[model samples]
Target: MASTDDNGVAGYDILRAPGASGGTFTQVGTSTTTSFSDTGLTPSTTYRYQVRARDAAGNTSPVSNTAELTTQPGPSSGTCTTVPTVQTQWGTGYVIQPLTITNTGTSTITGWTATFTLPAGHTLSGSWNGTATVSGQTVTIRNVSHNGTLAPGASTTSVGFQATRPNGNTALPSGYTCA
Candidate 1:
């Protein structure tokens, strides 16, 4: 929360693992403040979280203590779907496709995620408009502060990324599921 030049933390990075074990940890997001609430989590499921601090100059500290979260059980209040559109393509690397997320539920939704499997030889590098992270071949895209909320009735938002692809395989990612 405090920002200073002397051993000061400029931001924080939070990571999560499904349930308490077995699943690997993945970077969920980076926040300029101290407190963060991870979004796009399953209802009535357990999650493990760890955070690290980053300085103004981009130096990151070691992982902090781990915490667990168990969301309350309920019929999830919202529905969403994502369609990946090719934004650009080139040799070896292509600008990450923009994923369009549409809100189909009746109520207003606060946050969402677009999960997909990276194609063979494609690797995620960075993104804009949300947090983009890859674990193995699975890519998880989560909402940042500004673009999280969506009104009902086909409200749509998008996130884009940068990745490398096979020279001939400039195709976009497939099998995207919104949550």
Candidate 2:
């Protein structure tokens, strides 16, 4: 956002409109920088952005040129792995902590799921930032609305879960497959 007037631009208000021009405009964020990186966007989706410049005197300029962008699909050859670490533990209960899902390929990963095993004696009791479902020893964790998009070489730390550990086994989850 260039200086809209002689007073110089103080900040920027970014608005995004879904689909085409007729859609409703929603203010995305306010930033002092010239560029913004939006995450958690669905792959193969299109969005329209309109930028407005705000002066030091609190005056706003007319909407600038609209920029349209379409996100590319996830990598066909990309690799994603969920690495779990221990955060805390107690009697008959333990936490899987927050796991980092890293995208090792050259393309962005969208709408991801972290698959792992909970071991025989552990059962999921609570979870956050994702949804977890267990079938036998296999656990499938899906990303929430946010934190779903992982850029190339990007690592997102998410999916902390509390599970009942009845067998006193403190080992981390295994079979960490992410997609």
What pairs collide in candidate 2? none
**Residue lDDT tens for model 1, 27-113:** 999999888877777888999988988888777878888888899865437888888777777888877556788888988778888
Best by lDDT: 2
TM-score of each: 0.56, 0.55
* Highest-TM-score candidate: 1
lDDT of 2 by residue, 11-104 (tens): 8999998875579878889889898887888778889998898988788878889999998975445678888888888878888767887888
Number of backbone-clashing residue pairs for each candidate, in the order shown: 0, 0
